[model samples]
Target chain A: MTTEVLTTTGAPLLQVRDLQVTFTTPRGRVRAVDSLAFTVEAGRTLGIVGESGSGKSVTSLAVMGLHRDAEVGGSIALAGQELTALSEKELSRLRGRKMAMIFQDPLSSLHPYYTVGEQIAEHYRVHFRSGRAAARRRAVDMLGEVGIPEPARRAGEYPHQFSGGMRQRAMIAMALACEPELLIADEPTTALDVTVQAQILELIARLQQERGLGVVMITHDLGVVARVAHEVLVMYGGRAAEQAPVDALFADPAHPYTRGLLDSLPRLDDSDDEPLRAIPGSPPSLREPAPGCAFAPRCAQAAAGTAQDRARCADVRPALEPYRSPDRLVACHFAGVPADAAGRTPANVPVPGPATVRPQGTDPDQEVSR
Target chain B: MTTLKPAAGPAPAPADGSAPPLVSVRDLTMTFPGKRSATGRRGAPVRAVDGISFDLAAGETLGLVGESGCGKSTTGRMLVRLLEPTSGSITFDGRDVTHLSQGALRPLRRHLQMVFQDPHSSLNPRQTVARIISDPLLVQGWAAGDARRRAAELMDLVGLIPEHIDRYPHEFSGGQAQRIGIARSLATSPRLVVADEPVSALDVSVQAQIVNLMERLRRELGLAYVFIAHDLSVVKRVSDRVAVMYLGRIVEIGDKKSLYEDPQHPYTRALLSAVPLPDPAAERRRERITLLGDPPSPAAPPPGCSFHPRCPKAQPLCKTERPALTVAAAGPATREVACHFPGD
Candidate 1:
């Protein structure tokens, strides 16, 4: 893979620092994203993964300058240009040309009344000021580039006329029409089936290879991150819980939240009948987060720790810093604890049954009495 | 927990055997009207679920997995009597309930329940959680005090705090709302639950919690589940047997181990290969079988085998002769597939 080579060779195309997004609601001020930071280099993918209310989508929206009413703070830069300092007019000019975004539901994101070609051409014409005919031709070319069959005829159809996968392809064609340097895809394949998801992911990876585009793929599926992302950022309670290379994050996750997520996932290859280790509590409320670690209340390690360790967890928040490995960053106080030492239950280890009972995996013996 | 176990009796026979299944369908089919054809005449009907048959045993999960529009949801609705089947017979516990009138179905409704996909829309926002969970009991003629007590117990069984029973659906998160939905489905202590894409709309972590809860309930209550989902991994976790559907037909049906490990149908193989595993090493090393094009529309399906267009192992016979599901040469003797060439 050229991902490792491309990641270390050049400056990051997108850098976010101390980003915070808060929305004023009727109940109170909701801090959706708090002090989140990450960088994405050209020709590489940075996958942001979390459950609902984890601020992954909010961070993407903040980078795209799409939040009109919410209060956004901190720094966001694109190719040496500070996005936070740019005016609305300047940001609009840079949106489709320099950076673009694709949403999860293509049907809702796309205009229902307009032809698919007209939408794509309009997106291209806005930035290039090209003739209508030229833009239309580019639209057809882009539709073909995304592997949509019969591009010329399909381009004339409305969003409703196309299938789910084709609509997503048209959405991608529109996003890439202007040749943006950065692409922020928020759950691009989350709405599609597994087969279509694989196709869309392959298309994105191929396009990124050809254009060296920086990609920020936001999704909740860790399998997707393992397949496509160069680096991964795990979020919890509107903050970054852990960040590491894709392989490292999967092989040995440092934070308890990440570990719980991995253990909870039911693997297709695994055929064991053991119960899944579900995370005990739901996600925290972002409006009034815990004073210390956001995940401390639900974390198994924090519950089993000594009084001093528990006090530190409840009183002082831990900062995201390097743990053991320089490339891997974790926000947990006991990040380096071994799995068994942290009271993590080993999965798929069979326990002995009652003396009179037969083993679980084998067929029940008819001779055994009740 | 030990007292919860039933008497140690002989293992139940396969639902496909001569013994009657808890829920049985013979030649089930459903079709919807479509637009006119190019000849300006009435077009062919859209075959949502065309001539499919399967069975659900007591205390067993039968996973129906397919892509969107494959008619899995339509089949689920038919089993629960929510939709009138175009043509077929549904035998429940030796009684034919296919075309029963609404008045006659009232008594049978207590034995079957359904859980929908979108928790937000499935639940009524105006109603309180207590009212939602107790509605089934109320419909069944339970007293008000008894129904409320049952609803509270159901809430605790599904891991929801009892104090939040009075709150409306809008107050809970997606996961909590799904728990409420589960509680409502179990309010009648139904024998069969047809969950149509229940956890697909939830987050991955919350999805695990719901799956675990459903598994535990099945064990404790001895409830049979018709688990329908597009996620193969999730289906594998919950299903004892699985039936893979494509273009409104069953392409393969077998035990979970046989179907996943040695899929006989080319479509099943492609679908399994497309799923991304969380292991980076395995993902990088595995070879993928990408199908050529999108599924053909059900209204205008191909002449012979519907999967011929995208099948990698398609032959000339596949274009002219429709295959029938039969015992496969490989795997278990009970395993069945509708492919001419059953194995790689």
Candidate 2:
């Protein structure tokens, strides 16, 4: 994976600060992303995790400068250069070469009529200013680069001819064709099956390492975040709920929403007797200007506290502040999980199986379970 | 009404072993006509479901899970006679309902209800919440006034505002719409409900709400369910017993604890491995088995063992011999596996 990127020390590869994105729908002004801030360094994956309507996808689109009907404000910098101020033509020039994005549905992203190889070749030629024959070679190489078997033959086939996983691989191959320094994958593996999802995640991680590309992964699945993310920023109502290292966040989530999310998900290892402790209410509507904390209504701690605690939480929006460690951020006024007691919980370990579980190849059990 | 007798005839059986299973499926198969090509030649018939069998005791939950086109949805449909099985029998409390005529099946519709994957699409867009919820009751010979009253009661039961019964589906959020779908499924107080990926469309937080609601309903009503989904973790959360499907066959079926903790069939193991666990440490330590390729086309399935093509533990014998479903020789005798070399 030969590539060229600005290899500067001290500064991060991609910097986003106070990024706000709003849509003017018939209903009202919907602030999809509300002053969300995060950054990604080269060779690292920053996962932006949130549920539907949390503005995770909108953040990715704003970075790519792809929002047409929405207003985007604040700063998005790549390689120390601001992107929000760039013109459409200027951004287009930087898109395939400097930064690129992959979406959830590969079929919709890939053109149906054109052969997969020809599309990749066209994209490569447009960005690199190369001849068709030379670009075609690069396209086939990329197909092979993403681990698609029979790259040459498959390149000649259309998107419809390829399977779901192969189509996604082709999309990744095309996205990395110009060797972008920054990659924003918005729910890239959401549409894929779990097995294929693992393969794609491994491919991206490998490519990120070899090319030293900064990656921002957006998804609702915590498992995907756990697998690939070095740092995670959990979003709620288009605002930052919590931010920390992957292991630390999962070990002891500071935000109530994050805690509720972890509680809601049914772990494979947990006994069946325990009913899922789902959060009582649904996510807040972002159509209106939400006063105070958007999550106060659903926050269990706020509800259980005294009248003053509840009033404070409902009357004032909690700013994203450092939670114990400077690196960790939580946006709840009453965020729990004290730093002194942040022990690595055995919640990460699965209950051991009996000796007679799998005798044929007992080793696989160690890989899947604790 | 005359149509209510068939469904009411069966005395509610005890969930214990003292009575037979409420629902017993044996070698159920479904084959659809092949698609005709531009050249006017038809392709091979698709065996969406091929000889799969299971039993669901009263109030029991059977989780049917597989990847896309593995026939989990098709199996769920067949249980409620949505799509008639091409072969084999579906016995409901010792009564064979497989080949029953539509006229004869009318009463049984009250006993078995279906909650679809997409909440919005399954419901009528033109109808109000009241109309949507009362449709089943109306079909079961209830008067309009009585059904409407029942609809309002159901709204409150499913955690929806009773006043909102006059509102349209679009007015409600995704989670609320799903609640309406659950409310409709329970309109006639069904004995067995087949929920085909009911919560897959909603957000993670909202998914918890739906799962909790279903669990509460199941406990209160003593209802049996065939929970169909692709997510293994969610299946493990709700199921008493689970069946792993591959290329239209039940490769493995057993008690949820044993099967998930120690999967017998190679495909089941691989399927379980594919699921991404939420904990980062567990994810880092756990080994994953990536299957070679996508599941083969059901239209032209592979010879002998269907999973042999991508199976990690597949042997040459798997290529020639189609293993029949049999009781496990070691460990749990209740577990049934179809692979020649089952346990690792």
Give me the displacement of residue A240 in model 1, in angstroms: 0.6
Model 1: runs farther than 4 Å from truth?
A1-10, A339-370, B1-12, B35-44
- Where's the lowest-lDDT run of ten residues in candidate 1 chain B? B1-10
Root-mean-square deviation of Cα positions for candidate 2 versus the true structure, in angstroms: 8.7
lDDT by residue for model 1 over B1-344, one digit each (tens)?
23223332223347866566888898999998888868888877899999998887878899999998889999999999998899989998789999999889988897789999999899999999889999988999999888888888888788777777898887877778888899899888888889999998887767888898899888887888899999999999998899999989999998988789888888899999999999888999999998866788998899888899888989999999989988877746768889887789
Q: Model 2, A76-136: lDDT tens per residue?
A: 9887789999999999999988888999999998988899999999999999899999999
Leading candidate by lDDT: 1
Per-residue lDDT tens digits for candidate 2, residues B158-216, read 77878778988887777788888998998887888999999999878878888878887
lDDT, model 1, position B246 = 90
lDDT of 2 at B42: 93
Extract clashing residue pairs from model 2: A359-B344, A360-B344, A361-B344, A367-B286, A367-B287
lDDT (10s digit) by residue, model 1, range A1-370: 3334435645568999999999999989999999898998888899999988899999999999999989999999887679999899999999988889999999988999999999999999999999999999999999999999899999999999998889989998999899888999999999888888998999999999998989999999888999999999999999999999999999999998999899989899886579877765567778788889988766656655655566677768999999778999999888968544434333423233322223343211111100
What are the chain A TM-scores of the candidates, in order?
0.89, 0.89
